[model samples]
Target: MTAAPNTTKPSGQDSPSTDTAVLRALRRIRVPQTQRNRELFLLIFAFLVNGSAIALVQLGTMGAIDAAFLFYCGALIVLVLAMHIVLRLFARDADPFVLPIATILTGLGIAMIYRIDIAVELGGWDAYSTKQLAWAAIAIVGAIAIVILLRNYRVLFRYTYIFGLAGIVLLILPIIPGLGTDANADVWVSLGFFSFQPGELAKISLAIFFAGYLVRTRESLTAVGTRFLGMTWPRARELGPLLVIWLISLGIIVLQRDLGTGLLIFGMFVAMLYVATGKTSWVIIGVVLAAAGAFLASRVLPYVGGRFSNWLDAFNPEVIDRAGGSYQLVQGIFGLAQGGLVGTGLGQGRPYITPLSQSDYILASLGEELGLIGVFAILCLYMVFTSRGIRIGLAGQDDFGKLLATGLSFTIALQVFIMVGGVTRIIPLTGLTTPFLAAGGSSLVANWLIVALLLRISDAVRSRPRVVIG
Candidate 1:
């Protein structure tokens, strides 16, 4: 009788021992309906916050709630609901907080920009607020398309080098003779009717290249290195990838006059390298290399040196009064001081006194209006967004997804640091738009696309198929 016992074990969850009773096979799924529900709830609050802020802006600045503004807000809210419905069907398991946080930040920026328009007495389609709204609409459409069409982001891995080349071409486009605008920084491309910053999209392409390349070459990077300063440094041969990226970054800084973007691109790679290798030495090497490049640039380029001087002696009478002086910097600082612990209450503050309030100085303008408490809230939103993004990367089952999610998320966080550091006088100022909160068509589109990518990644991480038997 004992010979009747079989000894084969089941590879799947359906073990023979469960044959005593009826085994009901059920597939367990998580975070589709629930994630979407959470997002919908958060979206309600976001809508309320944005609507209140806009209503208050009109009351404080125009002394009446314009019927048209209410209609406009209602239309935007409807558009957002449509987006939510689309996300539910497409990226059902995406991080719930990411979209809502972006929604609030963009709304608050528009509210502030609208108030500024009143202060400057600009109106109609010419106002930056109007243009920003149009851009936001276009960006949302682009984001939706990505989320829907790019069901499997892994396809991008196949075109790694192609993305890298595209990134190079984009970086170069803004420097081409006829295409580049006549701005102080050669970072924009003009196509007759509209202008764009190619660096914005270049970020996405380059990040993909970096993630894919590192995923394949991580073993080589981590395998062989020389010991130096109590740490393992990459061998001269292993250093090729890093050196190439560094040189390209330097070229951007020196040629395009885009110090922020150059820094953004290089810093992104350094962070990704650390993620790939799990070594502190790479970070140290990155800092050293960046400092060296910066010092060299300061010597070769007068503007770079001037930026450093402004950072150091912004209050100097000679520096403040110069043609391209620190007047704006000083004015922004005074605005922050005026904001105190609590801001001057929305549109009541004179943020127009600060130059470039709607763009580069948007944070200072917000600080002057909403105060320190508001600024901290905004920063906290960024922290949440970043944490969610990093969490998605950590939860990924594939190397490429892990590196890509983490790298892109780190880029957003790095950009925040760069912008905030400049505004608070923690670093030399360079032009980098605040994500989701600055008035730029290019930036808005890029930001939404980044959000879409993160959403896609998070969904992929959570929605892997599973089978169970009991």
Candidate 2:
């Protein structure tokens, strides 16, 4: 009847419609592929920058390049390329910036470690730089394994309680008699030739557990809070979980004598808790509790008391002369001052003058050589990395992913602030490594795993189709 009436739709119009649909599909497919190409370019740039740093260190320290150093660099490049291939296969839509940023930071750290090793005359496998490179290789492999195995980030939510229990066990491992080894802090566990910091692993597991737990209980937490002083506060009954976490943190501080890890774990929980509940009063309560804990810790814990004293009276001759005094803090400040605006040109600066220059004081070491501009550049890398993580969190499709990403990003931001502040004399020193730029196997492994998880989440977020309802 329609043909008879000559009322059929035009074929010309239908051709245009089909072309438009095909174009839209092609665009959708090309976006992720283009993003992957950009990632590859950035990764190549990162590799070149890292390689140059290694070469510079060789030339500056020994006046020539070493074949062994080149071999190490080649191995690193191969491993990193392998990681990039893994990402291409499994995490095609993931953020392009994360891996490159991590690579740059890790490379800078290795270069600095090697410089320090040269200054100290350490050689072969005994060199800290060699060990750092080895750890880098291991960490990269671990990250590759994670991206391949943990294809779905949401699966972690299924075993929330199990993750929590595992975190507790990890935290307690260092306290066990034969397993635990005392280092600068009592957070290390030794197994034959291998020593690791279980607290590092514990923090990650705890992040997953906290994300899952908060997602489940967020409604209850946000529902019945009281308003006070322009803020909503949870009731005393509601504060039970927080109190338990605080006590656990305090136990870590007192028993393990690790104020940094304790503070990190507790602060991460508080940040995530505030984010989940959208309550400022939780922050206030956290601050008040933190202050009270600090006060008591200063009065009762000798180490805490000493740190406070150092922060307050760093320039005092008596404090400076005391054992475990403000000498390291003061030295770090001098190094920063010496660095001025343009740094001492990498190998020319005396970063080795600072205590634990390769680990806790790496930021100060970098400041001494890179100068203020260089230091700020390094900080910018961290800032970008953290901001990218936050962006991923904000873009997530699920509440659990949002909390997890935010918490992980906050954890890194807080750690950097604390470490930098301590080195700059803005706060009392605590023993936390500077993420990718520090020389520790546990920290390296944990941070790489973080990178892998974030990649997984970003891939999932980007690949999901957006719905536009009329």
Candidate 3:
């Protein structure tokens, strides 16, 4: 007080008070500790519980609780460590809840597969459950690597067409001799040690392409065009590309007997169109187009006609006689019946008896074991996830981000609806997999990649500075 000399420090000198304020601000902005950690721990717990339940069921089947217990414990430890290490890399920006949700779905799928394996083993047949477990491990590692490596979403926009071409190529690859196997006309490629389905990748790559393309053309598409029926119709010239794509996709369905994948791709296109135009009229047009296409296909394509016929008479005993068509639907319906309300418990239901139990009919198996409640829970999870995606789309800073989010979100929404509708008999059966829950390498990998992109866009939204307008 006598002099208080030099109390005002040099401008370059750090003020302890200022430093404390900055640090406090940073702490406030840091990731929420409770939310993030809680989600992670819950997923880890889910993984353990799922594995243990699988082992218990397997042991109950084989009367070898000790061995199954040991194996289950080991597998759980491996999966958790693998997932943790993977998430540590690229998923840092992902929603705190995304990984946890994925974890539960993935873990549950594995458990169901393991349960099937035990049942098959008891019948003296080779069990693929162990193989499925191996694939799950691979998928987790792949997801982590993709998230870490693909740190930028903008790159996708740049290479959307290229990726789309690659996806189309992959889809057509199964037609190659010695490379593709025909399964009811839908080509399945054998990758020597493992077989891969290209349809999954096609869905994602095409979505990227659609997002980039639609974002660029949306304004034009919605702008001046021949006004008809109180709507701004896109010029025939402007609509040509979409028609070509629709035809190509339709051709694929008719030619390859891959109705489910074709329907999914078409649905993606229609949804993108609706988003771009924001026109209810376009939806009506789309439905009309879809109906027309379906009718034409049924009139021309044998498989399509047969499927439509089978769908029309689902309850007829004669319809269920067809191995390539209605049998799965009939069985799936019966399985759901078996799982009326609360389910038969995780390992108790007869899910494995259904053909294609791990693919399109996985939902049926899920319903059989987990019951209607479980199905509802899963649908709710998808709904929540979709809602978050929509929020991200709306909050995105650019057209590309918004379209990307919307397209990706709608892809999932439509796929879930189609598959769930198929399983519940609300609609004719479409052989589409449940996104994260289905057991397929390509589907699993592609879906996780989608999650990664969504997370990146979401982070961009979250990290954006608040804008104050005068």
Candidate 4:
């Protein structure tokens, strides 16, 4: 009772102690400010590079700057600035390099699209470049909304099953009779004036689902069941999830007729699974499954078989001359060859001579115009972006965040590899877009969403208190 009576301090003395405690708490919780400044500076440079590319395209093509270019540039700047503001408000401690890298890639894509539009004499709203700019704006808005709404990446873990269900629904949407649109691949869903690839959104939803699912089941998955060639493998029963995913991927390839997306989705799952379990055996199993899937698809599916044929005999006279043959592949190769050491200068190249110059074969068009050096620079940008995302994943404090980041980052890397490798004849072309550098609205939206998620994760990781092991 005496000790309790002496515990109460004077109000005057208590006020100072309370204030000191408050200051200390504030110091601990205060967001890091320097990273944002570096991001801002890089963003400015990205904008300059983007603007210059547009200007150069205008000057190189039309010989003068036009009102359309100016308007698009102004709108792009405003949209990006708004995104930057939103980031500052919600993700103050996010990675500094991701946003700028995405911006530069998007801008470069638009510039290239615009250049192609001019070459094709496509003006007004009919221009692919105009559509690209609009999509870019929409993508920025989507990113902003994601940052504001999903302040914590961990909240996604609460609805893991819901995300998985949503992803399945999205994947099947493109195959629905009335809703589906038949393009080169049966992957698009049309709603009157708008057509979209649901697979893009499906990828994001699936990544979340996979991250959460693996986190909850990591112990069982990682428990060693068998040993072979100095590696411990999971039990056959433990691989039910992988088998299900692989079958779904095969279905995508066979039914939807999109080998690229099938490969992309399957590859992402394998990458995430390996990271979660830290098992090379899972990778071996995945590769074996992938090889089997590819072999089966090549034999049974005409589209998949055609891709293999194109890859193997692209320059063959009969193969190149046949309808829906290797003509596109050969043209892409020639375009790259034309580029050589240095590109033919943006507007000077005949990139439009190749089909889908602004979409599927856009990289070839870019290679033809930017040369090997420019392609190298663009590849370097992708390398940095992917590396930063992996770094964020590695630094994550939670298993879900790490897997999600890794899956998303690996998705980008895989898509880039598929596109580049296909175009270079290192693999069969899969018709996947080159991430932020492509002319597809669906791709741009999906990629920007990824950037937003990575930003949120990075902010959480940086803001969280670190544990120092003594």
Candidate 5:
């Protein structure tokens, strides 16, 4: 015979004489593995596309596959996979599309750069493609570290003023003697053995500063504006920040001779301001200020005037024959025309015909080889990327995170527009390089940092604690 055991019911909740306690289950916005697994699948596709691009380039140009380029592709994939692994381990809730999109775009860049190298008969470690791969490795590693280390993106708000000051210093680094390079644009900073455009990093720092600053001051900026032109305009006191940023931008155009970056920084600030305040007047003010600045810059800066001339009259023989001519722009246009609706098929078309084709004009290179369809596809990818970033910002719970993500997203969108618009003659060509599709180490590293920060913010957004509801 077995003895029956008596058990007492738990007492805190559902007891007749005691106060009932509320019970809640811990909940997550998503299963962490779901996001990570989606990311992995897309990464595999990106790898295949990148590898296929290299294969096509080699076969089209060299009549056979090059083992060296294959090795380069392998190296690049390893770096990309390394970032994926870091995200899986540290940021499982991160957005799935961002890493894969960045991987494919940058991988395509390498493949195109290699095509140009082969066309130009350049090889070995000195090849620009090889150097670009090296930069990609550095950039990917930097991104991985950022993802792993930056568990919380909000800590950045504590140092808002510091970032703002640092952005100014970075913007001015090129003007400092012994550090500045005498390029057409004084945006490069050299350290004997290494040189990079400080403006690239400046954009990131400024975005952070702007996000934090706006979060702290949005109320004052939005509350006390005058009604005018069917829009509420900020008071004179509020205009101080706008005026300061505008002056800084003009200084970039005039002192640093970097009209593209100047416009980029100002545009980033303005976009962020609009996001924070939700006011149309800020955008109107920003455009008027930008337009006024551009008009003034065109008159005072020879470089600005030259870019306008080259842009408007690229086909003119006189403009083509000038010291700083539209010859490059015209060639880029011809290359795109030759590409037509469908590209000339990778290496078959002569992307190397345009100077700096792998850098400032890489879009033209890709457009020529891949055709109008290919460029449209690339533009669509940009749309997807920016949309993802904006979505991430909108999903955040905190103002700083939202503004920072939006600012960073807008920075990428604006840079692409500036660079691609210039390349297409939709706007005057500025010194801005195409985001991931161009060969600039500074741009690569800085852009990857933005990606990492976005991933961090997105993961945080998803992982914020919630009460499970039946």
Candidate 6:
């Protein structure tokens, strides 16, 4: 009645303007500046500590900064600066935890790589420290750019099929005529002066595809189908898709002759399926199928069969001396055993004795030089990393976020387990890189991208506004 007595309010009473609203919204958006600063500080500290330590060791050995040492130090400084700039430019909003972890691990990796390089130079194999520094610089730039540009991981779901197909093609491309190069353990693409492993990229893409696919299909995959002995099996149609993936994975193992990457990819799928569907039976089924495939592979594929045999007879008189198979493993065990409790000191041990010491056998090198204490530190870092990753997965608000985090975390866990287990004789040899610690361009870049994805997911999870619904 009577326009509610002009309850709208008198003159001079007004709400905030559009401009004010914009400023207020910006304030509410938490720019992640403080976290970024903390990461920057940590990166600087780690770089200084690691770089200075290297200099001190070199100085002690060669007695002061020689021309080669100066050149190396100058190059390293420039590269580190470049990488730092790249991180600031692209990953400004990334989760604080990722960059610091990356920095610490990268520092450790560089130190180890350089340590191996010095030994290799003395042995006439032409050490790769320079090239490794270059690769690390490029990887850091790429990681930052990816985190900045690809803010929404969900966009990957749109191109899941394309990514999956391309990934499969890449995994098998190593078997293609004139394209693949069998670098000791197999799985590499030789491009003249620069060789790269496509499986590194393929693994990440496939994990994305698997996560997106499994999350979408878990409902049907877990639904009760036909009952057998009081147990419900997935529908035939549902099983068909999984079987196809399994076959593809096995094909990678056989054709590419890379059991490590094959097992990694398969483990990713199985883990994601279990996480998405919450079905233990699916895991059991996947394991059984994997064992059956392994049996068949052992009998058929000579290379695979040899690997299993080598793993079995690792200490046998006949297998211990062969350079191609058991030599590295035997040397690795010897090195670790020599380290015992106190290690041989940083630059004192002969880690380069093992083939591919900077890459696949880096763990062995670490064990020899760092000893049990240093190796334990490395293990603790991984444990911290996994614990943080799992926290991110649990904190994520959406299904895709959860799956992505879980898949990434599980992938790292599996890689570490396979590598450490192989070196420690807990499992058969699998030539997988120790993430962040291994020396390979493709691996470094791929792993950095993984860290970026986790950072992005963590940012989303952390920034999400809570709401109450009745």
Q: TM-scores for all candidates?
A: 0.93, 0.96, 0.86, 0.92, 0.93, 0.85
Per-residue CA lDDT of model 2 for 158-236, tens digit only, reads 9999999999999999889999885756899999998999999999999999999999988877877677787777877
Provide the lDDT at 239 for model 3.
Answer: 70
What would you estimate as the lDDT of candidate 5? 0.90
Whichever of 3 and 6 has more TM-score, that candidate is 3
Question: Which prediction has more favorable TM-score, 2 or 5?
Answer: 2
Lowest-sum lDDT 10-residue window in model 6: 461-470
Query: Which candidate, 4 or 6, would have the higher lDDT against the true structure?
Result: 4
After the best TM-score superposition of candidate 5, give how far the Cα of residue 299 lies from its true spot, in angstroms: 1.1
Q: Specify the highest-TM-score model's number.
A: 2
Cα lDDT, all candidates: 0.90, 0.90, 0.73, 0.90, 0.90, 0.76
List pairs with backbone clashes in candidate 2: 343-371
Ten contiguous residues minimizing lDDT sum, candidate 5: 18-27
Error in Å for residue 452 of model 3 = 2.4
- How far out, in Å, is residue 241 in model 5? 0.4
Clashes of 4: 1
Off by over 4 Å in 5: 1-30, 466-470
Error of 2 at 249 (Å): 0.8
Mind sharing the TM-score for model 3? 0.86
lDDT by residue (71-139, candidate 3, tens digit) is: 744664575556555544544434666666666677677667667766666322235555555666666
* TM-score preference between candidates 2 and 4, better one: 2
Quantify how close model 6 is to the true structure by its C-alpha RMSD in Å.
Answer: 5.1
